[model samples]
Every structure is written in C-alpha cells, then in structure tokens.
Target: MRARRTPEPYLWLLFSGGGVVAALLLPVLVLIFGVLAPLGVIEPPPAARVRALLDPLLVRLALAAVVGLCLFHAAHRIRFTVEEMTRGGRLDVVLAPLCYGAALTGTVIAVLVLF
Candidate 1:
C-alpha cells in the first residue's frame, strides 16, 4: 500500500493557528481601538504617532499576519458550518474552496495594503 497524502492537515493547521491568533489578539485590539479609544476611556494616539508605530516593516508583517489569520479563522468556521448545514454533501466540494479562497484573497489584499 502507498501512503496517501491529503491537504486536510494543512487546512486544519491554518484553522488552529488562526483560532489561537484570533483568541489571543483580536479581543485586545477590539477593546482598545474599538471601545476604549472611541469612548474616550483611553485617549487615542495622534495620527503621527499611529503612523510612526506602523512605520516599520516588521510591524506591517505582524499586522498582515493578524489580519490574514483572523480571516482564515472565520473562513474555517464558516466552511464547517456550511458543510454541517448541507450534511457534508456535494456542497462541501464547492464550499471548501470558496471559503478558503475568500480567506486567501483577503490575506493577499492585506499583504498588498500593508506592504
């Protein structure tokens, strides 16, 4: 018998990684930028300071990863949900690529915008 290879492991890895990144960082970002800064619970940094903070290439790469991973996390969740709803029928074949493709597209766009 020959060993069979599948892409499932890689997809699952991305899903797990994205989940960790989203759980660890998304809430903090949302709380700080979305809630605190907007409500003035914390003063927002000046535009120049924000620009300077994001000026470095490393910072941009980090931001891109966060954004891209979050997108992949969402895509994974949605793909499974859709598959379950469809009872893992033929629709799965269609949904898999669509969901992941959207994530990949968003990641590419983020890379372009960030870089």
Candidate 2:
C-alpha cells in the first residue's frame, strides 16, 4: 500500500501562524487605529508621516504579512465552523478550496495594495 499524504498539517500550520499574528498584533493595531486615534484619545499621525512610514520596504512587507495571515486565520476558522454546522456533509469537498482560495485572493490583494 502507498502512503497517503494529507494537506491537513500544512493547513493547521497556517492556521496556527495566523492565530499568533492576529493575537499579538491585531489587538494593538485596533486599539491604536480603531479606538484611541478615532476617539481622539491619541493624536493620529499626519497623512504624510503615515505615508513616510509605509514607504520603507520592510514596513510594507510587515503590513502585508499581518494582513495576509489574518485573512488566512479568518478563513480557517470559518471553514471549520461551516464544516461543523453541516456535519461534514456533501459540502466537505468544496469548503476547503473555497475557504483557502478566498484567503489567497485576499493575500494577493493585500500585497498589491501594500506595495
């Protein structure tokens, strides 16, 4: 008998990596941009300053990674939730590709937009 390989390990790795990135960075980003800045508790950086910050290649890469990983995290969660809801029915075949595909599409858009 031939050994069968499964994509589950790789998927789970992406899921875990995304979870870590989201956990560590997303809250701080939200607190800074979504809450404090918007509420005027903290002064928002000037548009030119923001643009300058993003002008660095490293900064752009970091932003892309954060956005891409977060999207993958969301996709993984939604995929499992959908699978559980449907009790692993006929939708099983389509769910993985659909979920991961959306993640990849979002990642590409993020890269393009960031660059």
Reference-based TM-score of each model: 0.88, 0.89
Q: What is the lDDT of candidate 1?
A: 0.89
**Alpha carbon lDDT at 48, candidate 1:** 95
- What are the per-residue Cα lDDT tens digits for candidate 2 across 1-115? 8879988888888889999999999898899889999999999978998899899999999999888888888988999899889788577689889999999999999998887
TM-score of 1: 0.88
- Give RMSD (Å) of candidate 1 vs. truth: 2.1
Summarize candidate 1's per-residue lDDT along 1-115 as a digit string, tens digits: 8889978888888889999999999898999889999999998988998899899999999999988888888998898888888688578788989999999999999999877
Cα error of candidate 2 at position 68, Å? 1.1
Top candidate on TM-score is 2
